[model samples]
Target: MTELLERCPVCGKTDLREKLQVQDRSVSQETFTIVQCQACEFQFTNPRPDAASIGRYYESAAYVSHNSGAQGLINQVYKVARFFTVRRKVSLITKLNGGKQGRLLDYGCGTGHFLAGAKKAGWQVTGLEPNDLARADATTRVGQPIEEPSALGTLAPGSFDIITLWHVLEHVHTLNETLDQLIRALKPGGKLLIAVPNVESLDAQHYRQDWAAYDVPRHLYHFSPASMRQLLSRHGLAVRQKLPLALDAYYVSMLSEKHRSPERAGGPLTVLRAGYSSNRYAAQHDGQYSSVLYVAERGA
Candidate 1:
């Protein structure tokens, strides 16, 4: 067995603790360890898999496009529903800032679906995608060129009015540097929206090591609301809103369970029941299940 070796990327802490150990799609066996910086409350993955190993998992066909097919009917409906929901949210935010006339950039835009949607809604849209196939798909789908993060240097500083990282923050190798680039690209008062799995949610606690969101080596950072706020504050961005968006917890639970025991295939009824309970819990409580949508703004 190969021993995992890594250091805390956030607080420069070498002292780490094992949080959870589980199996994942990328590795035969994996451990999700959370290393805490005593100096700062910052916690991140230690002994994380190298970039090559993690990249193999993402490059697979299973991850090429959004896995809409893996979801059930209700989940599918929600996926479609979110299109309108996201549009409305963006529209409201843009309206609040005057109108949607400024440039919008979507980081990690897989196949450029959201960017296409944003363009249709009247925002000038651009995208950054690392995967070649995904980037090609985005170019075809959005009918515009999608650039890698490295190419971002060509654009003038402080040019964008809105920037989005929809579930892309966790995969970044250099979280601070990536965020710095994003922040530098945004004009003063520009909005930056980020959506990621909430480590402090009920689903996280229930699944623990088997949590799908941890995603082992793929997800380098597991963010709580407080941690995310601190990260933004460090970069001169003020967190304006933290909305708990309804996510398909049942599906996530299914994946987590499957990752834990690949041999045990969960039945449809069991998955449905879990999903219902998760939805009910989220509805009753304050968005405590799956994911969170963060809205922040650059300070003058």
Candidate 2:
């Protein structure tokens, strides 16, 4: 089943324009159209696979978050990148909480790598994974049972000191509802970390429709910092900081290069150059990295 959105989720605007049609490179090769709202500059996959049929699109082993055991050069590279990124994430969480240990909910935890790191760093971690395989893997890694998306409604109000959605919000169908639940679960003034791809980033502009971050049907929405702020502000959340996922530039560049036709795929040097250029551009401009990690706080 496919669902077509008539209004923009961010600003509730009906004035939407088709931006581009991108193919699902990871799973189905079917093309999907990306539409942008003139009011908020928010882009989303129109006529996207609805919640029921969406799982089929993520059924491949190439979906890194769900398949920790995935084998290949890219997967291997991802593992190494994840090692450093996870540590950074943990450190950032601690720093954000003012070096206090607290209850943390990792929504869309994805094999629980970050949860394990946080647990070792003295945090009470709870993981929620939608995928069965990934949930099982996360359970084993965290040495605790992982809950499903339905658990969001079951969480007590003001229960968690922190809630994180790392590249997970884009995939959610009930965007506003999910945010409401998450906010309700968070303690007053609790931190909410949301990491997502930035469509306005240099790499995204460079690759355009061929950008791997698009990931088509999988990434239902393409967000910019401005668009994200509008969305969060609607729920009474304020962005405290905008940090860059530094290594994403290189990873995204590599995947973007591979997405191009054989002649345009370019070599490893070209990929590295694109990544470096993206980072440099972000440094000069606002910190709009290929992927942005937004540290937001709920109203007290």
| Model 1's TM-score against the true structure | 0.83
Give the residue spans of candidate 1 off by over 4 A.
1-8, 11-14, 26-32, 38-41, 64-96, 260-269, 272-289
Q: Which residue pairs overlap in candidate 1's backbone?
A: none
Each candidate's lDDT (Cα)?
0.72, 0.93
| Local lDDT at 162 for model 2 | 87
Clashing pairs in 2: none
lDDT for each residue of candidate 2 in 67-162, tens digit (9 for 90 to 100): 898988888999999999899889889988888889999999999999999999999999999999999999999999999999999989999988
On residues 1-300, what C-alpha lDDT tens digit does candidate 1 reach at each position?
A: 122534454555566665555445644454456666555555566666666556665644355244433355544654676667667666755774577467888888877777887787778988998888888888888899999877766677899888888888988876888899888899898889998888766777776777777876677788878778878887888988877666447657766666555565566676676666766776687666577878899987
Model 1 has an lDDT value of 0.72
